[model samples]
Target: MTKDHVNYVYDPVVLKGRNTEHPVHPLILSRSSPREMSGEDIPDRELMALFDAARWAPSYRNAQPWRFLYAKRSTVHWQKFLDIVKPANQAWCHTASALVVVVAHKWTVDRETGKPKEIPTASFDTGAACMALALEGSGRDLVVHCMFGMDFEKAYKVFGIDRDRDGVQCMIAVGKRPALTVRDREPRVSQRNPIESFAFEGGFVKVYHK
Candidate 1:
């Protein structure tokens, strides 16, 4: 593992400042996925800013195929969106300031062939865009949590998503994090697998071990 990331995953005290030994930005290390959302609505401009950040993520063939469906906490659509989430997820997520559904175009017409072809990187690129949105929200001190704990069939029906062309990629809950209540579970940061476990040098010829 890179020393900085190792410190980040194992030693909180070593990650005290932006200029800590970590090689990346402090925002990355500090961001957390918290379930205790404050239920306050985000300002419209602030919310759009997150989307604006997502707009810049790179994609294959320059096909930025991601689409976002968003609903603020108090809107009629918000309840409808919340109802699609599993009750376990909704128990914590209903307090989020906004619910964002990430979708991707599964197929795009080939410009040259004039025929539809699967965009192999559509889901991959959408995930990168989601990270961009997450980083932007974290920079603004907002907590963002992405999930798979929703009813995809219900989501497709409610959002009018044509599954043949579009994929319901994932869901995100965004809000200013709230203080944990006694009844609420304790908030804790999770660890990551060491970089050594995943990163390879020349090729996938060999894997690193601690």
Candidate 2:
């Protein structure tokens, strides 16, 4: 167990964005994903608060089809959750206070037809829930990091789900931010592309221009 990591309390990296860029909340600007973490254990009440935020996210047809499986660092299931992480991620994930598996139900039975049909936005809806959960974690002064570097097949078996009915989306690790050394030694902030590059206006394939 990497419980001793709490002693390496490195200063947090501050991410600041100019207000002139956009009228965004400070929380949105300060949010960041850093690899190093202090291995302090989060209480159950605080953990539940994060999930509560996820539960309130909007979903199509009110399905809200997201499910989560989580384990605290001190629990028996902790190692099981860690096993699915990619090698590169484990370098920091091992010290997280809690690990989570985010799953999306791929299909649902229609009330009228009584036959199962694929939920077109299942994954997207789940992503929205995950984001809500992350932001909530941030509000509580906790650092949240989502990682796709997990073995989906292994997770499917570990979580005991049928591939046809459910999709193993990703994992979320939560804890206090770690020292810069826990991540790439040379810690430099990453930049998102300017709005015009990805956001489009009038038509598909057309980017928004200032």
* Each model's total of backbone clashes: 0, 2
Give the whole-model CA lDDT for all candidates, comma-separated: 0.79, 0.80
Tens digits of per-residue lDDT for model 1, 1-210: 122211112123223422333376565776657677888888987788889889999987878889999999888788888888899999999889999999998888899999988999999999999999988887776778999999999999998999988999889999875665212453354566666667678877566456
Query: 20 in model 2: Cα distance from truth in Å?
Result: 6.0
Give the winner by TM-score: 2
- Score every model by TM-score: 0.82, 0.83
Clashes of 2: 2
Mind sharing the TM-score for model 1? 0.82
Model 1 lDDT at residue 78: 85
For each candidate in turn, give its C-alpha RMSD to the true structure in angstroms.
7.3, 6.5
